[model samples]
Target: MDDKMHELEIRIQKLTQVHATDRVRQLISLLIKDIGEKTDASTIRIPCPLTTTDLARMAGTSRETVSHVLQKYKASGKLMIESKIITITDPAFFMR
Candidate 1:
Protein backbone atom coordinates (compact mmCIF):
# COMPACT_ATOMS: atom_id res chain seq x y z
CA MET A 1 0.00 0.00 0.00
CA ASP A 2 2.88 2.40 0.71
CA ASP A 3 4.45 1.65 -2.65
CA LYS A 4 1.16 2.27 -4.37
CA MET A 5 0.84 5.59 -2.60
CA HIS A 6 4.38 6.57 -3.61
CA GLU A 7 3.64 5.68 -7.23
CA LEU A 8 0.51 7.77 -7.14
CA GLU A 9 2.46 10.68 -5.73
CA ILE A 10 5.02 10.45 -8.50
CA ARG A 11 2.31 10.34 -11.12
CA ILE A 12 0.63 13.35 -9.62
CA GLN A 13 3.91 15.28 -9.65
CA LYS A 14 4.48 14.44 -13.29
CA LEU A 15 0.98 15.55 -14.20
CA THR A 16 1.35 18.84 -12.37
CA GLN A 17 4.64 19.50 -14.12
CA VAL A 18 3.09 18.83 -17.50
CA HIS A 19 0.18 21.12 -16.75
CA ALA A 20 2.50 23.94 -15.75
CA THR A 21 4.51 23.49 -18.93
CA ASP A 22 1.38 23.52 -21.05
CA ARG A 23 0.17 26.69 -19.39
CA VAL A 24 3.49 28.41 -20.07
CA ARG A 25 3.42 27.38 -23.72
CA GLN A 26 -0.13 28.64 -24.11
CA LEU A 27 0.84 31.96 -22.56
CA ILE A 28 3.89 32.34 -24.81
CA SER A 29 1.76 31.61 -27.87
CA LEU A 30 -0.78 34.21 -26.85
CA LEU A 31 1.95 36.79 -26.25
CA ILE A 32 3.60 36.09 -29.61
CA LYS A 33 0.32 36.25 -31.47
CA ASP A 34 -0.58 39.51 -29.86
CA ILE A 35 2.87 40.91 -30.59
CA GLY A 36 2.68 39.84 -34.22
CA GLU A 37 -0.58 41.61 -34.73
CA LYS A 38 0.74 44.76 -33.16
CA THR A 39 3.91 44.84 -35.27
CA ASP A 40 4.39 47.45 -37.92
CA ALA A 41 6.01 47.22 -41.35
CA SER A 42 9.40 47.99 -39.87
CA THR A 43 9.62 44.48 -38.37
CA ILE A 44 9.88 45.73 -34.83
CA ARG A 45 7.08 46.16 -32.38
CA ILE A 46 6.52 46.94 -28.75
CA PRO A 47 3.26 45.58 -27.54
CA CYS A 48 2.50 45.95 -23.89
CA PRO A 49 6.11 46.73 -23.14
CA LEU A 50 5.90 46.07 -19.48
CA THR A 51 8.04 46.33 -16.45
CA THR A 52 9.27 43.05 -15.04
CA THR A 53 6.61 43.27 -12.34
CA ASP A 54 3.77 43.69 -14.82
CA LEU A 55 5.07 41.01 -17.16
CA ALA A 56 5.39 38.59 -14.29
CA ARG A 57 1.86 39.35 -13.30
CA MET A 58 0.58 38.73 -16.83
CA ALA A 59 2.43 35.44 -17.21
CA GLY A 60 1.91 34.27 -13.64
CA THR A 61 5.64 33.85 -13.29
CA SER A 62 8.31 35.27 -11.06
CA ARG A 63 9.71 38.66 -12.02
CA GLU A 64 13.20 37.21 -11.93
CA THR A 65 12.27 34.55 -14.45
CA VAL A 66 10.71 37.10 -16.75
CA SER A 67 13.81 39.26 -16.50
CA HIS A 68 16.07 36.33 -17.18
CA VAL A 69 14.14 35.15 -20.23
CA LEU A 70 13.81 38.62 -21.64
CA GLN A 71 17.50 39.23 -21.20
CA LYS A 72 18.30 35.94 -22.85
CA TYR A 73 16.09 36.73 -25.80
CA LYS A 74 17.61 40.15 -26.09
CA ALA A 75 21.08 38.71 -26.02
CA SER A 76 20.19 36.24 -28.78
CA GLY A 77 19.00 39.21 -30.84
CA LYS A 78 15.60 37.61 -31.31
CA LEU A 79 14.33 40.51 -29.23
CA MET A 80 15.60 43.89 -28.06
CA ILE A 81 15.49 45.90 -24.92
CA GLU A 82 15.56 49.67 -24.70
CA SER A 83 15.62 50.78 -21.11
CA LYS A 84 12.72 48.78 -19.71
CA ILE A 85 10.88 48.49 -22.99
CA ILE A 86 10.84 45.08 -24.66
CA THR A 87 10.67 45.26 -28.43
CA ILE A 88 10.33 42.33 -30.79
CA THR A 89 13.31 42.81 -33.05
CA ASP A 90 12.55 40.01 -35.44
CA PRO A 91 8.83 39.99 -36.00
CA ALA A 92 9.07 36.72 -37.96
CA PHE A 93 11.51 35.22 -35.48
CA PHE A 94 9.01 32.79 -34.00
CA MET A 95 7.40 31.63 -37.23
CA ARG A 96 9.47 28.48 -37.15
Candidate 2:
Protein backbone atom coordinates (compact mmCIF):
# COMPACT_ATOMS: atom_id res chain seq x y z
CA MET A 1 0.00 0.00 0.00
CA ASP A 2 2.81 2.36 0.80
CA ASP A 3 4.57 1.49 -2.46
CA LYS A 4 1.39 2.09 -4.38
CA MET A 5 0.92 5.45 -2.70
CA HIS A 6 4.50 6.44 -3.49
CA GLU A 7 4.01 5.47 -7.11
CA LEU A 8 0.82 7.50 -7.27
CA GLU A 9 2.59 10.48 -5.81
CA ILE A 10 5.28 10.17 -8.46
CA ARG A 11 2.68 10.01 -11.19
CA ILE A 12 1.04 13.14 -9.85
CA GLN A 13 4.36 14.93 -9.73
CA LYS A 14 5.12 13.93 -13.28
CA LEU A 15 1.76 15.23 -14.44
CA THR A 16 2.27 18.49 -12.61
CA GLN A 17 5.71 18.96 -14.10
CA VAL A 18 4.49 18.16 -17.57
CA HIS A 19 1.64 20.61 -17.43
CA ALA A 20 3.50 23.36 -15.59
CA THR A 21 6.92 23.38 -17.19
CA ASP A 22 8.35 24.10 -20.60
CA ARG A 23 9.17 21.32 -23.07
CA VAL A 24 12.88 21.26 -22.39
CA ARG A 25 12.45 21.10 -18.66
CA GLN A 26 9.75 18.49 -19.00
CA LEU A 27 12.02 16.28 -21.06
CA ILE A 28 14.91 16.85 -18.69
CA SER A 29 12.84 15.91 -15.69
CA LEU A 30 11.48 12.82 -17.37
CA LEU A 31 14.90 11.70 -18.44
CA ILE A 32 16.25 12.03 -14.96
CA LYS A 33 13.38 10.21 -13.33
CA ASP A 34 12.77 7.48 -15.89
CA ILE A 35 16.21 6.72 -17.22
CA GLY A 36 18.60 8.01 -14.62
CA GLU A 37 19.90 6.62 -11.35
CA LYS A 38 21.87 8.60 -8.87
CA THR A 39 25.29 7.05 -8.48
CA ASP A 40 26.36 9.57 -5.86
CA ALA A 41 25.26 12.83 -4.30
CA SER A 42 25.61 15.08 -7.32
CA THR A 43 25.84 12.81 -10.38
CA ILE A 44 23.10 11.02 -12.23
CA ARG A 45 23.75 8.26 -14.73
CA ILE A 46 21.36 7.30 -17.50
CA PRO A 47 22.43 4.08 -19.09
CA CYS A 48 21.31 3.60 -22.66
CA PRO A 49 18.84 0.84 -22.83
CA LEU A 50 16.62 3.66 -24.06
CA THR A 51 16.08 5.61 -27.24
CA THR A 52 14.99 9.04 -28.34
CA THR A 53 11.77 7.64 -29.79
CA ASP A 54 10.85 6.23 -26.40
CA LEU A 55 11.65 9.55 -24.78
CA ALA A 56 9.59 11.43 -27.39
CA ARG A 57 6.62 9.18 -26.74
CA MET A 58 6.95 9.73 -23.00
CA ALA A 59 7.46 13.48 -23.35
CA GLY A 60 4.59 13.84 -25.85
CA THR A 61 7.02 15.43 -28.26
CA SER A 62 8.69 14.59 -31.54
CA ARG A 63 11.90 12.60 -31.97
CA GLU A 64 13.44 15.61 -33.65
CA THR A 65 12.56 17.80 -30.69
CA VAL A 66 14.05 15.33 -28.27
CA SER A 67 17.23 15.20 -30.31
CA HIS A 68 17.39 18.97 -30.44
CA VAL A 69 17.02 19.45 -26.72
CA LEU A 70 19.55 16.70 -26.02
CA GLN A 71 22.03 18.34 -28.31
CA LYS A 72 21.59 21.66 -26.59
CA TYR A 73 22.26 20.06 -23.22
CA LYS A 74 25.29 18.29 -24.58
CA ALA A 75 26.67 21.54 -25.88
CA SER A 76 26.00 23.32 -22.62
CA GLY A 77 28.05 20.74 -20.64
CA LYS A 78 25.10 19.90 -18.42
CA LEU A 79 24.75 16.49 -20.08
CA MET A 80 27.16 14.02 -21.56
CA ILE A 81 26.22 11.20 -23.89
CA GLU A 82 28.86 8.73 -24.85
CA SER A 83 29.09 4.97 -25.44
CA LYS A 84 25.29 4.86 -25.35
CA ILE A 85 25.13 6.25 -21.82
CA ILE A 86 24.08 9.68 -20.59
CA THR A 87 25.51 11.41 -17.55
CA ILE A 88 23.97 14.48 -16.01
CA THR A 89 26.77 16.60 -14.61
CA ASP A 90 24.58 19.03 -12.75
CA PRO A 91 21.48 17.43 -11.38
CA ALA A 92 20.49 20.65 -9.61
CA PHE A 93 19.92 22.33 -12.98
CA PHE A 94 16.84 20.22 -13.46
CA MET A 95 15.77 20.39 -9.82
CA ARG A 96 14.89 24.05 -10.16
Candidate 3:
Protein backbone atom coordinates (compact mmCIF):
# COMPACT_ATOMS: atom_id res chain seq x y z
CA MET A 1 0.00 0.00 0.00
CA ASP A 2 1.02 3.59 -0.38
CA ASP A 3 1.01 4.18 3.35
CA LYS A 4 3.27 1.22 4.00
CA MET A 5 5.70 2.37 1.38
CA HIS A 6 5.80 5.79 2.91
CA GLU A 7 6.50 4.33 6.31
CA LEU A 8 9.23 2.14 4.88
CA GLU A 9 10.83 5.08 3.20
CA ILE A 10 10.74 7.05 6.41
CA ARG A 11 12.32 4.18 8.28
CA ILE A 12 15.08 3.94 5.72
CA GLN A 13 15.75 7.63 6.07
CA LYS A 14 15.83 7.37 9.82
CA LEU A 15 18.31 4.51 9.63
CA THR A 16 20.62 6.60 7.48
CA GLN A 17 20.34 9.69 9.66
CA VAL A 18 20.75 7.71 12.84
CA HIS A 19 24.32 6.99 11.92
CA ALA A 20 25.08 10.45 10.55
CA THR A 21 23.78 12.62 13.36
CA ASP A 22 23.42 12.85 17.10
CA ARG A 23 20.48 10.78 18.29
CA VAL A 24 19.21 13.51 20.59
CA ARG A 25 19.07 16.03 17.78
CA GLN A 26 17.44 13.55 15.48
CA LEU A 27 14.86 12.75 18.13
CA ILE A 28 14.04 16.40 18.75
CA SER A 29 13.76 17.07 15.05
CA LEU A 30 11.36 14.20 14.66
CA LEU A 31 9.34 15.38 17.62
CA ILE A 32 9.01 18.85 16.17
CA LYS A 33 7.88 17.45 12.85
CA ASP A 34 5.34 15.16 14.47
CA ILE A 35 3.98 17.99 16.55
CA GLY A 36 3.83 20.26 13.56
CA GLU A 37 1.86 17.70 11.62
CA LYS A 38 -0.59 17.09 14.43
CA THR A 39 -1.26 20.71 15.26
CA ASP A 40 -3.82 22.61 13.20
CA ALA A 41 -2.99 26.13 14.30
CA SER A 42 -0.16 28.55 13.54
CA THR A 43 0.46 28.90 17.25
CA ILE A 44 3.93 27.94 18.44
CA ARG A 45 2.74 26.46 21.66
CA ILE A 46 0.91 23.19 21.14
CA PRO A 47 0.34 20.25 23.42
CA CYS A 48 2.12 17.11 22.29
CA PRO A 49 0.24 13.88 22.82
CA LEU A 50 3.25 11.62 22.60
CA THR A 51 5.16 10.67 25.70
CA THR A 52 8.93 10.66 26.23
CA THR A 53 9.05 6.88 26.08
CA ASP A 54 7.11 6.86 22.85
CA LEU A 55 9.47 9.44 21.41
CA ALA A 56 12.44 7.38 22.52
CA ARG A 57 11.02 4.35 20.76
CA MET A 58 10.41 6.30 17.61
CA ALA A 59 13.90 7.77 17.74
CA GLY A 60 15.42 4.34 18.41
CA THR A 61 17.00 5.55 21.65
CA SER A 62 16.63 5.11 25.37
CA ARG A 63 13.95 6.83 27.44
CA GLU A 64 16.63 8.26 29.68
CA THR A 65 18.23 10.05 26.76
CA VAL A 66 14.92 11.56 25.73
CA SER A 67 14.23 12.64 29.30
CA HIS A 68 17.65 14.28 29.59
CA VAL A 69 17.29 16.13 26.33
CA LEU A 70 13.77 17.25 27.24
CA GLN A 71 15.05 18.63 30.53
CA LYS A 72 17.61 20.72 28.69
CA TYR A 73 14.94 22.00 26.32
CA LYS A 74 12.73 22.88 29.27
CA ALA A 75 15.56 24.74 30.94
CA SER A 76 16.19 26.65 27.74
CA GLY A 77 12.51 27.67 27.43
CA LYS A 78 11.94 25.56 24.37
CA LEU A 79 9.33 23.25 25.84
CA MET A 80 7.72 21.79 28.95
CA ILE A 81 6.10 18.55 30.06
CA GLU A 82 3.30 18.14 32.56
CA SER A 83 0.89 15.27 33.00
CA LYS A 84 2.77 13.51 30.23
CA ILE A 85 1.71 16.17 27.76
CA ILE A 86 4.52 18.17 26.18
CA THR A 87 4.06 21.75 25.08
CA ILE A 88 6.47 23.21 22.61
CA THR A 89 7.06 26.87 23.47
CA ASP A 90 9.63 27.46 20.77
CA PRO A 91 8.97 25.25 17.80
CA ALA A 92 11.98 26.72 16.08
CA PHE A 93 14.30 25.36 18.73
CA PHE A 94 14.40 21.96 17.09
CA MET A 95 15.38 23.48 13.77
CA ARG A 96 18.58 24.68 15.34
Candidate 4:
Protein backbone atom coordinates (compact mmCIF):
# COMPACT_ATOMS: atom_id res chain seq x y z
CA MET A 1 0.00 0.00 0.00
CA ASP A 2 2.73 2.37 0.87
CA ASP A 3 4.68 1.46 -2.28
CA LYS A 4 1.62 1.97 -4.43
CA MET A 5 1.01 5.34 -2.84
CA HIS A 6 4.61 6.31 -3.49
CA GLU A 7 4.33 5.23 -7.10
CA LEU A 8 1.19 7.27 -7.52
CA GLU A 9 2.90 10.23 -5.96
CA ILE A 10 5.78 9.96 -8.40
CA ARG A 11 3.37 9.70 -11.32
CA ILE A 12 1.48 12.73 -10.13
CA GLN A 13 4.70 14.64 -9.80
CA LYS A 14 5.66 13.80 -13.36
CA LEU A 15 2.28 14.85 -14.69
CA THR A 16 2.33 18.03 -12.66
CA GLN A 17 5.78 18.92 -13.95
CA VAL A 18 4.50 18.82 -17.53
CA HIS A 19 2.79 21.98 -18.51
CA ALA A 20 0.48 22.37 -21.51
CA THR A 21 2.93 24.90 -22.89
CA ASP A 22 5.94 22.59 -22.63
CA ARG A 23 5.18 20.22 -25.46
CA VAL A 24 8.82 19.48 -26.09
CA ARG A 25 9.39 18.23 -22.56
CA GLN A 26 6.27 16.09 -22.75
CA LEU A 27 7.36 14.59 -26.04
CA ILE A 28 10.84 13.90 -24.74
CA SER A 29 9.46 12.17 -21.68
CA LEU A 30 7.11 10.08 -23.77
CA LEU A 31 9.85 9.02 -26.15
CA ILE A 32 12.19 8.11 -23.35
CA LYS A 33 9.54 6.07 -21.61
CA ASP A 34 8.12 4.32 -24.64
CA ILE A 35 11.17 3.20 -26.57
CA GLY A 36 14.38 4.51 -25.13
CA GLU A 37 17.01 1.97 -24.11
CA LYS A 38 20.46 2.58 -22.79
CA THR A 39 22.94 1.62 -25.47
CA ASP A 40 25.99 2.93 -23.65
CA ALA A 41 27.01 5.34 -20.96
CA SER A 42 26.05 8.42 -22.92
CA THR A 43 23.55 7.16 -25.51
CA ILE A 44 19.97 5.94 -25.62
CA ARG A 45 18.27 4.42 -28.63
CA ILE A 46 14.62 4.42 -29.50
CA PRO A 47 14.60 1.48 -31.86
CA CYS A 48 10.87 1.32 -32.37
CA PRO A 49 9.77 2.67 -35.69
CA LEU A 50 7.72 5.75 -34.97
CA THR A 51 6.29 8.43 -37.20
CA THR A 52 5.54 12.03 -36.35
CA THR A 53 1.89 11.18 -36.10
CA ASP A 54 2.66 8.31 -33.78
CA LEU A 55 4.77 10.53 -31.60
CA ALA A 56 2.06 13.17 -31.58
CA ARG A 57 -0.45 10.61 -30.40
CA MET A 58 1.89 9.30 -27.74
CA ALA A 59 2.69 12.78 -26.51
CA GLY A 60 -0.91 13.94 -26.72
CA THR A 61 0.06 16.74 -29.07
CA SER A 62 -0.22 17.45 -32.78
CA ARG A 63 1.84 15.99 -35.60
CA GLU A 64 3.16 19.43 -36.48
CA THR A 65 4.34 20.00 -32.94
CA VAL A 66 6.13 16.67 -32.88
CA SER A 67 7.82 17.46 -36.17
CA HIS A 68 8.88 20.86 -34.95
CA VAL A 69 10.32 19.54 -31.71
CA LEU A 70 12.15 16.75 -33.52
CA GLN A 71 13.67 19.24 -35.91
CA LYS A 72 14.79 21.40 -33.03
CA TYR A 73 16.37 18.43 -31.29
CA LYS A 74 18.12 17.48 -34.50
CA ALA A 75 19.46 20.96 -34.98
CA SER A 76 20.62 21.12 -31.37
CA GLY A 77 22.48 17.79 -31.63
CA LYS A 78 20.35 16.29 -28.88
CA LEU A 79 18.83 13.58 -31.03
CA MET A 80 19.07 12.05 -34.45
CA ILE A 81 16.18 10.79 -36.52
CA GLU A 82 16.73 8.59 -39.54
CA SER A 83 14.37 6.08 -41.10
CA LYS A 84 12.18 6.01 -37.97
CA ILE A 85 15.09 5.34 -35.63
CA ILE A 86 15.75 7.86 -32.86
CA THR A 87 19.10 8.02 -31.13
CA ILE A 88 19.44 10.28 -28.16
CA THR A 89 22.92 11.77 -28.23
CA ASP A 90 22.98 12.65 -24.57
CA PRO A 91 20.77 10.48 -22.40
CA ALA A 92 21.66 12.44 -19.27
CA PHE A 93 20.18 15.56 -20.79
CA PHE A 94 16.73 14.02 -20.84
CA MET A 95 17.06 12.22 -17.47
CA ARG A 96 16.52 15.56 -15.81
> For all the candidates, what are their Cα RMSDs to the real structure?
10.0, 3.5, 4.0, 3.0
In candidate 1, which residue pairs get closer than 3 Å at backbone N, Cα or C atoms, i.e. clash?
none
Candidate 1 per-residue lDDT over residues 1-96, each given as its tens digit? 999899667644543464433433344444665564455664555455568777667556677776777776678887776766555666555433
lDDT of 2 by residue, 14-51 (tens): 65565422555656666687778988888899776557
The order of the candidates by lDDT, greatest first, is 4, 2, 3, 1
In model 3, pairs of residues that clash are: none
How close to the true structure is residue 1 of candidate 3, measured as C-alpha lDDT? 100
Cα lDDT, all candidates: 0.59, 0.72, 0.66, 0.74
Model 2: lDDT to the true structure: 0.72
Top candidate (TM-score)? 4
Worst 10 residues of 4 by lDDT: 19-28
Of candidates 4 and 3, the better by lDDT: 4
Candidate 4 lDDT, 1-96, residue by residue in tens: 999899767755664576533655555665687678888887788878889888777566678877887888789898888899888996656667
Models 1 onward score TM values of: 0.55, 0.67, 0.62, 0.72
Q: 1-96 in candidate 3: lDDT tens per residue? A: 999899879855864576422566665666566555444353243355677778777777788877888888789887767787766667665666
Superior candidate under TM-score, 3 versus 4: 4
Report the error of model 2 at residue 54, Å.
1.4
- Residue 91 of candidate 1: its Cα lDDT? 53
Against the true structure, candidate 4 reaches a TM-score of 0.72
Leading candidate by lDDT: 4
